[model samples]
Target: MIPELAPAKACAAKVLIADDEPNIVVSLEFMMKREGFEVLVARDGRAALEAIRREHPRLVLLDATMPGMSGFDVCEAVRADADVRSTCIVMLTAKGRETDMARGVGAGADAYVTKPFSTRDLVQQVKDMLAKDTAARALATGSAGAGELPKDMPA
Candidate 1:
């Protein structure tokens, strides 16, 4: 539990952390909870996709590699679906190559985070992406004022 609110953090956006590694999952869950986001988990790509369809979370921290149906596949599926296309995706994995990042981007991932990532950086990045996404949604819906970014978000 995060005792104090962190700057740039939002109110409990549901986020899915999909990874097969137990240790990584545990750490991610704890970190997300501390950041005031409701964390969900899936051990494999299939389960991750199922959860995404069912929960429609605000964000998904997807592992690039899994036993079956890689994260690339999952991201592509999410992008193909109009309903879930707006969902923010952050691909997390050990593959840090330029090609891997390109593949993730082509698959519609909003961000790509490599393994051994700093938790603080991850949290900040999550906050920033979620904020931008919220602003975009407001603009899309015509709910925000012409001058005001959603929730006073900086330009």
Candidate 2:
């Protein structure tokens, strides 16, 4: 419910942020807005599940560690939900351990980025996710445009 990101004001593409730390959520919300993404914040995994049900954001940035319903649990819930399973998920955490990465992968996150990540990287990741989603939808709707097929389709 904090102030929305600036760039997001124009495009209005929604993004969900799940993290326990207030400062991290605030900073990411501001940065995502500056990069043109509407931002939603959930302080814990249960809140994140509710937001996903209500808002259905294009992407979710999930923190691996939280007081309740850890990121892994959240990810599992999302993956299980048919309505929001396709939502792009990027894990955020201070823990860079190899085992942690394995667990994140096991949880079915689409992408994983460590804490202290560069703002540029985060913005690019969002853009890439949106573009990928657009492409996927186009393909699913059989509307890759007239005289055009998906790049991977046999010519």
Q: Worst lDDT window (10 residues) for model 1?
A: 146-155
Instruction: Give the per-residue Cα lDDT of candidate 1 at 41.
Output: 95
Per-residue lDDT tens digits for candidate 2, residues 53-119, read 8999888999988877899899999999999998889999988989999899899988888888886
- TM-score list, all predictions: 0.85, 0.83
- The digit string of per-residue lDDT tens for model 1 on 1-155 reads 86986677334688999899999899889988887788899999999999999999999999999978899999999999988888899999899999999999999999999999998889889889988888778878889777664553322
Best by lDDT: 1
Candidate 2 residue runs with Cα over 4 Å from true position: 1-11, 144-155
Task: Tell how far residue 94 is off in model 1, in angstroms.
Answer: 0.7
Cα RMSD (Å) per model?
Answer: 6.6, 8.7
TM-score of 2: 0.83
Compute the lDDT of residue 134 as modeled in candidate 1. Answer: 84
